[model samples]
Target: MASAEGIFEGRLRELCKQCPPWYKNPSLVRLYLLLIAPMMTTTAWGFDNALTNGLQSIDTFMNNFGNPQGSTLGFFGASMSVGGIIGCIVGGPLNDRFGRRPLISGGALLIVGMVIMQTFSSNFGMFTGGKLLLGFGAFIQQCAASVLVVELVHPKQREALSSFFNTNIYIGFIIGAWITFGTFRMTSQWSWKLPCILQLALPAYQVVMVWFCPESPRWLISKGRIEEGRQILIKYHGNGVEDEIVRVEMEEIMAGIEADKTMIKANWQGLKTVLGTKGNRHRLWICIVTAVGSQALGGSFVAAYLPQILDQVGLTSSKDKTLINGMMTIVNWLTAIIAAFVIPKVKRRTMFLFATAGMTASFIIWTALTAEYVKHGHKGLGIGVVVIIFIYNFFTSMCWVPLVIAYPLENVTTKQRAIFFAITLFSINVSAFCSSYLNPVGLAAIGWRYYLPQCCFNALMIVIIYFTFVETKGLTLEEIAIIYDGKESFEEAVHYVSMELNAKHSEAVSHVEEHTEVKA
Candidate 1:
């Protein structure tokens, strides 16, 4: 192995050679460091998900939780999604009215309390109630932190950086899996109980750290604190120069805020505004479909109920199922990390359509293969089902993991962003609630045909993607609204702003101009 100093020197050389000097600046470096705190909330989310899913397969949890039947298990699991729906609705208004920083700081502490409730619960009702709170807190953190990170960064870095926000969740998932796997033989209730109690640590740490992180500049601007938002933009992207890029970015942000204030019907009457206009309806349609497709079709199944599903499918060994569950999360994290990088290079519409296609095919194949294993009792077929399930997860993660959450944040204006997010969260809650209840019931009732509905959902999602979704790559936040507003064609807007794409020193403010409305 190379010596520490040699390795350090090589890494430094790589950075110096591959990266520009601005990335090494102290101000930018500090801003990046601060983002770590908001991200910790996602890590905790993964930990809980991993812990919950793995524990579901454990004998101790089954006994303590009263060995829930498939539908019963689904009902108990559905409790979390129900809570998430409420959180999204409630938290959206709070976040929009208050600010992103307070929401996260407070939500972190809230999760700690909820986890404590579950940790010491004495009955199924109490435990289910705690799970509801857990979903409430997690979605609150997840939804807000997502909008926060995307809003803080530069246009070029927006998609790529925002995708990393969930990277920690996968890490938490891995840790949660191992933690459950390690405690599998404890011969006591502590195995499941300990993990629930241990969750308190993540939120506790987030409370202390998130307090120090900078508030989102976009939120600050919307509240008429323009100077503060400008300063933050400078401090992070200014690279100490207050360069042209920063000026154009601020201009674009201003245009977006103004447009949103006037045009977004929901800026006035909350939910009613969501259904008011063609524009609002269009935005909501995208939000609802993506959220429903992601949770109901592919993502939630593996994350929440896979272990139980695995055990039911004749993979009867508790340890093996749990280990596979753990490995699946690791694979999930790895694929998401890969998607985070790969997605930026690909067009948003292209990626969405392809991911949907990939998922539809994977689901259909899984249903057939699992059906074969069920009918023939073939060991090789069972193994094939396992391989395909992991493939299913990768396809799910590659598509929904990065795009479903991050795209909507970028697609809408500031005024509706929170509401748009809430709408999506609402869809997720409904879809997840259905899936959470249906998965186990579906598995028991239909065997391998359980996957048939998932296949159909993605098939419908592909149609939505191809027709309704426009290409969002290479467009700044302000410019995106033009397309939504019928101001200019996406290609026209991209071309209009093409000159300022690499404006290092400071370009004219013309690129941020969306004054010319493109006629439909």
Candidate 2:
């Protein structure tokens, strides 16, 4: 019988010789899906509890302020974003220095503590403080979980599996919304508080569950702990498949480490590294632009204020509005699940194009119907607005959520991944902060005209994507690195395996011709 290393080496040679280089191994994909499941559930709880249904629960708190002031509610809403930004900025360096498991475990515990406090808070100050803490935990998990996923998987499967984090978020949102809406009708305050308390269970479960999982193999390799990284991979995959996966991973790791050694270090080096080079600059700009576009499309605004928005559309009865909002959450989850499956099979650019186009059309219809209701007092127009809202969210699940996470990962190297994760999370949170404050103010100032700007944003996004975005459906991390480095064209980068095969064939033909002439 062949030794494990011998078997692995033989298989790898066959794979390199026979299969396309960019094809993702199935085992890596399954591992990502499994590991990300709990993290997604926890992260999703933050939004579902605070943004989606919790905002409506706090309406009484907002109303009691005796003015149309969303300042306090906005503060509470934006607090999480602020905490998330801080978390991302700090968590990146910490993950780089310490490791993924410590951060994940610590952040989960923090979230559980903060969420319990949020549930029991009797005053605004206490409630907002709890939110801040919750935000800190959420952001920590966001940065750690995403970067860990990227580090754990191969380059080809990285984007697809990372996209699952967002998919799970929507799924959690659906579950949180259902729980909030179902319970809210029974009693007002407890309805929201119950959901917040329920979130505690998730992190508590993670603290225990994550202990069973190993540290990221990539992080281990990056720290010059190759033997340790191999051990963890063996433990994670078991002896049967471990040797093959480790060989493949080690090759990729050594390449990345060697490349990273040439990079210059300085103050704000992460920022400079991303923006100084032409390729890095272009990628940085794309991430920022896409992030801003995604936020301005009002997906978060719609989510945060869904129950209230439902009420505005003439579903005034609390019970009815809650039920409809719950239904919308379910629909959002189902559609997002579809997108998760669809993303790997289709081009990233293609998904964004279809999603943005559909979202733009939905917003236009919604804006028109909302205007009709406000102007002419038509009841039927309100129904149309509600239907359009559903369409907007469904398309949103298909496009913005997945791409926002996946594209950023695609554009940066492992050395820049942590820093870029921080920047992307910061942009997302900042936009969310502004949106949380602005949505209510916009609703007060121009009614449904808030959605009109979003329509325009979506239209602009379609243009941006058409001109600037590159398709990254089937490329390996090395190939992606080459594309982002401007060392190769997108087409050439994606079809690199084919190029290699042709070169090898040509070499073989030359050798055979030379042999025939010598024999003659």
Candidate 3:
């Protein structure tokens, strides 16, 4: 029996050897899976505070019509944005200086702490302070998680992998929305505060789990800890395949470092380097404009304010509101999951074009429905608004949400990546802060006319995506850099990387075959 078991083990090892390196690399797979939960939790927790509880708490204090005396409700809504701005400014340089693990762990702890504080807040000031801290923590986690995933994943799979992070964020948003609406029936404050407190579980788990996970090997290589990085790659890849994956990954890291040295400082100097040249400036503007276009399409406003909109549409029953919010969350997550699979097959430009057109059409339909409600006072208008909200989230999940996060990472080089992300986060928060205040007022004053502006924004987004946003599907980081710089065309960049990746695979196969022959 012992000999038979030994033979079975040997056969299993041989079978595994024939599999792809990615399949054999358990560490990478485990790391990817581990990140999903914490990311979802942190995102859910943060969104709960920003989009759900923050709004609910403010409404509670301000009597849902906003403060007559103009208390700190607006400030409370803006606190997260303020925290996010500060976090983006600080988190990137910290990630570059320290490793990804410390920031992730520390950020998680901070989120947990803030959520607890938020759950028990006595007054508006305490609630606002808690929100500010929560936003700061989320900012750290967002930047750290993003950079960490990119650093850890294979360059070939980077965009799709990065999209996973965005997907988790949507999932978190969905869960937070569902929980907030579900619990609201029990008690107003508890309904919202419970979700905020429940979010603490995610970061708590992340803090413990991340301790066991290894730091990004690419970061290690960048810091010139080659042997340490190699050991990690080996541990993750297993015993026999260590040297092969490490050598390739290390070469890429070294090349990136050499390229990065061209710009010594990644502060003002790095920003200038990316914008100093005419071509680089063009790329920068493309990134900036695309980001602005994405926000203006009203994705965040819809997600944060959907429940309130439902309330206004006469779906004010607690049970119905909870169910609808839950359904919306589920749809949003499902759409994002579909995007993860679809992104690999579709062109980014094509996806953006389709999504923009679909979203604009949906908004137009929604506007008409709202107008009909105002004129005729029919029940169907409520249903139409709900349908529009779902479609809005669906298109958002499918295109803008993923692209907005992935594109900037793809467009910028490593030296400029931190600064670029900082700028992007700033734009997002600034837009969010403005929208948070304006959305409620717009709803009260102009009714659904607010969506008309978004319709125009979406149309502009389609035009910009068609003309400016280049297709980046299936390109290596270096190839993407070249394409962004106009040194290569889209087709050429894709072809070059495909050939290089194919060559690398062939070489690995040959090495394995040679080893087998030697052993035989």
Candidate 4:
């Protein structure tokens, strides 16, 4: 029998032969539309970043919030990170038990109320409390929605869609940035509140529309609802036909589940399984590195403190700061979208290495430019800092912006994805919390020097990713197992699929020959 690796390659070729592109099919068009519900949830994250950055530039917002600075500003920024940490802990175990749709829809429902509370807040306590709760709901949605996109999407579209998924954060950022820009002129708290209200759009869509999207087929099959899972594959993946590609996909999914059965489900035993072997341990390491490195690499600095960074560089005008924030977000969004679409056409490891290296170089230059501007009070130097900021973002937008979720998903098995992703989110929250909480304090205390650590951290990441990261380009979630499992993991299932296809081909050839003989 051919090895699992050879069979997977053959299966892929066969799938391509049998299936049309998603754009050519009506069922696929509708399915992609439904995916929008989950995909848009990242906007909540992006919106919050832009909203806070914009609010800091507004004079009324400063007066209303008592001119928050130092530790107070740090906590205000970090509140969501704290809430996200809690959400990951609460939502991770329940994800496997309740399925993806409920967590996704329920999280959106929760955010709807939180957005309302945040929008109408009259005091710091009320506003921060609302933010904390909003983070809770958003992270819950993030944990499940990301998993659903990878599992439910047609395999042919998986890499592009999954990579594009994180870029949705930029969509939210764009909305939040522009809204804050439009509102900062108001004399009342309504300036900030208005942007908070606009956040309701995507979450509201998620609450209602996710119900219309199909449940993850892999989730269904894991629960023994095999026919329901098969039907989903037939409908979405096979374009409503029970074709050979669908059969092969089902067999592969089943084989993945069977291989994973030796591992424990959820809690401590699952954690042990994730770390029990060299391969699994490596996965955990990459997950942590991806989670923490993505945030700690100066992106969070710009996201949370761009207004302050602008102030140090001599562009203290609120209008100037907000405008730069809005424009930068647009550029970042476009870059991320382009990178996402290009993911399938390029190698994952190469993108990470390039993004991290470029970011490190951009940030180091950014630091020098900032120091020069602060020292000489030169507007030209400050402008150089601004330009470098965009350059830094371009590098991040190219890789970490899209792959942060997708690459980590590639590292673990389907069964352990929920638990492992929860762990990954935990690292993200911790790193993000450090960035959110400490960035303000550090900026206030050390000014331009604070950017130095991020530069160093980013430099280290380039090395780590180059040395440890594996290429996952053009592979399915199940096919990736062969990388760690030594090409022997799914041999039995591959053999079965091979034999089944061969038998069908032979039977069809026999029927054709019989028909020709009769006609003769």
Overall lDDT per candidate, in order of appearance: 0.74, 0.67, 0.66, 0.86
The candidate, 3 or 4, that scores higher on lDDT is: 4
Q: Considering summed lDDT, which 10 consecutive residues are worst modelled in model 2?
A: 1-10
Ranking of predictions according to TM-score: 4, 1, 2, 3
> What would the C-alpha RMSD of candidate 2 be, to one decimal place?
8.8
What does candidate 3's lDDT look like per residue over 417-485, in tens digits? 655666777677777777765676677667777778877877877887887777767655554555545
Better of 2 and 3 by lDDT: 2
TM-score of each: 0.87, 0.83, 0.82, 0.93
- Candidate 2: tens digits of C-alpha lDDT, residues 367-449: 88877887887778888888888888898888787778778876677666766677788788788888876777777677877
Query: Best by lDDT, which number?
Result: 4
**lDDT of residue 134 for candidate 2:** 80
Off by over 4 Å in 1: 1-22, 261-276, 488-520
Per-residue lDDT of 115 in model 4:
92
RMSD of 3: 8.8
**Model 3 misplaced stretches (Cα beyond 4 Å):** 1-25, 34-38, 45-75, 187-189, 237-245, 261-268, 486-520
RMSD of each: 9.8, 8.8, 8.8, 4.1
Flag clash pairs in model 4: none
